[model samples]
Target chain A: MTAAAASDTAPLLPAARLRAALLADRAATLTQLYRRTFPAVERHVRRHGGTAADAQDVFQDALIVLYEKALAETLTLTATPGTFLVAVSRNLWRRELQRRGQHPTAELTEAHFDELPADESEAAPALAVLDYVQQLGEKCRSLLIGFYYHRQPLEQLAAAHQYGSVRSATVQKFKCLERLRSAVRAAWARTTDLLTA
Target chain B: MRPELTRLQLIEQHLLGPATPADASAWQLQTLLDPDLAADAAAQQQLYAGLQLAGRQQLRQELQLIHRQLYGPGSAGWLRGAAAGLRSLFKRRFRR
Candidate 1:
């Protein structure tokens, strides 16, 4: 999308604006999106037999799913961002209710649920591997997060992290990823060995 | 650089999508001939997945920080009021 088009339409809604902001260094836009979108999510969860804490948890999880989709370049909302968030939050809460052996209200149905581009099952391993990543060193931790998750441009990333150049930063990022890869590989091996034993 | 790390850097370039068209085709041919390279490529994909998880965790923390800032101590907003209302309701029920 052209920068002019993005800028012109950004203030229209949080959902439409979030994609552009996330692709660049625009934290203020993110904050605005969160603030504007979250209250509706909270109201939805609360009206559906959930507490404020439950709303917070559900909203955070939904936001994570939204962020992941945005990063993967696959999030397209049919509704406004707030409405989309409410639908996701409702689906998540219904699932939570089912898991707890409580019946979800008939009001909550899949008709309004936006089809996620990826399956929850596919996200399983991504959520599963987070525990292993926490054990990585500070530099490796930050480097991987900055490069892969945040999508920081290499030039800015190098300057922020004080790498001599983009090439060095790129090399360092790969090295950090390699270290994380090995650690995750080792952890999987241990789990497999335990399962087989 | 060791051969293995060099191979990883090459895979990273491919995964990151900056490889020249010719270079990517060459790497594809190399993967076809070399099982080890293919295996490493698959493993590298998994590594990217893991990194995505790491990134999500970082973003979650940052967001939760924002949540706290918006609703934490000394804050008075709709969210804070909502939270306080819930706390009192739960507190009253538990006290009974």
Candidate 2:
């Protein structure tokens, strides 16, 4: 079956919903684009030491850039969503690398570049920071992961994880997060020492 | 556990976050006054960051699992169903 016939939904807005004469819209086009492209984007971001949360943020940001370009008629997505996002994430990652006094030509040409834009070059430096953070305990890990990385709301997290209430979840999430930040800060401090040596 | 501030109380300030609208001025002032409480708070922040990183890994795996279940070979029944539905539609539209 064609992608246009797939079960995808267009989020209807008030004024847009009233426009019946123009039923030529294919919601699946974008939905299909999201589904098809997101996996590659996620893989690329992850390889760069991005977590699922980071991938989501990168994908969303990449799409937002694409959307704005679409509105301006300057965005032509000849590459699939996966390729486009990988390219964008790579660009962002390279900039981040430069900020850390590192070369921007590492791990960018790994497996994810089968059909990528021709100039693929560097993995993001955020990976090392993420790696260090992954060592915290499960509860703290879950709480911070859900809120900051997954961007999950406190109330929803409370319900999903069976906390007594939103307040409890919020407190728990913060406690866990405190652990993560301290870990990162300490790790960074150590890295600075290594750099100085 | 510090005598001045319980673990839960310290957690509350963290949830309040650094720049929240809750205006956690009192807690900030307290943190400023107590060096030990401040150190514990800093440690908690580090732990929380690590947790956030771990959580994303879980989400990625979960998302992948869900995708596989949706589009796996086991769920290919939808293709046949779609074919039948298409056949019926064409048959009705062309019927005399």
Candidate 3:
């Protein structure tokens, strides 16, 4: 079945509602969002010589970008999520094609491209830092990610992590941050040393 | 805590803007006295940035799982039911 036809019954969600659900990282909202937007992404990918698998990959990446932007409260949606997703998916497909030394046959308007998500490459440095953070042990990873990234409260973090109290959780969180900071510094120093040497 | 660890905690408090004026001044003085501490402060900032990326990556993984559960082959559950609901809705409207 055509992607467009599949979404006939699924209505476009209000931007505010979609943003809230995304920020909360709700699975039900995300599933409904996928149903509402994936069709547009798939159609765009297919028209551009991508297969279903390619469409899925491109759409998933786009959704992740959207999730990041929404979590940061930075997404400003001038159109419905479908339109936005299609725009972002198109950008992703274009980059994918370029990486393969191919070009999109269909031209998108400058306005359309402008509304799409920022270049994924812009996040490469931060992504690289994350590559290091993942190498940290599970406790460090969870503590840092929970307090800093997820913005979990110290009391909840204490109970979840089985810390003695909020005070201890706060101390542990800072220590994990210190560990992460030291690791990042060491990595940076090594890279710079390599470059200069 | 060791002096360095206490200093690190103080820097953390300073950066997070909850450090008292006296503590902030002390952190400033400490970073000034030791270039290494200044570098640590900068690394601390980058570490926070990395933490943000890590957190987002975790969320992305969670979202990916949700995607797999809903759309993966051999999947049967509420997601499948939702799909079926949509198909029937479309079928009923098309029958009109």
Report the lDDT tens digits of candidate 1 across residue range A107-148: 332212234333435666765566666888887787777777
What's the residue-level lDDT of B91 in candidate 1?
100
Each prediction's total of clashing residue pairs, residues at least 3 apart in sequence or on different chains, is: 0, 25, 0
lDDT of each: 0.70, 0.52, 0.69
Global CA lDDT computed for model 3: 0.69
Off by over 4 Å in 1: A1-17, A23-27, A77-79, A98-132, A184-197, B1-3, B13-28, B77-96
Write candidate 3's Cα lDDT for A110-178 as tens digits.
112223344334656666678789998898798888767655556656877999988888778767767
RMSD, every candidate, angstroms: 9.0, 11.9, 8.8
Select the stronger candidate by TM-score from 1 and 3: 1
TM-score of 2: 0.42
Write model 3 residue lDDT over B1-96, tens digit each, in one string. 657668777667667665577887787787678878776666666677767767766876776676677666666645777888999999999999
True contacts kept of 2: 0.34
| Order by DockQ, highest first | 3, 1, 2
Model 2 agreement with the true structure over A118-193: per-residue lDDT tens digits: 1113322344446755676766666666555444456657877899998888667655545555567777789899
Which pairs in model 3 have colliding backbones?
none
Model 2, runs deviating above 4 Å: A1-33, A36-106, A109-144, A167-197, B1-28, B66-96
DockQ of each: 0.41, 0.23, 0.43
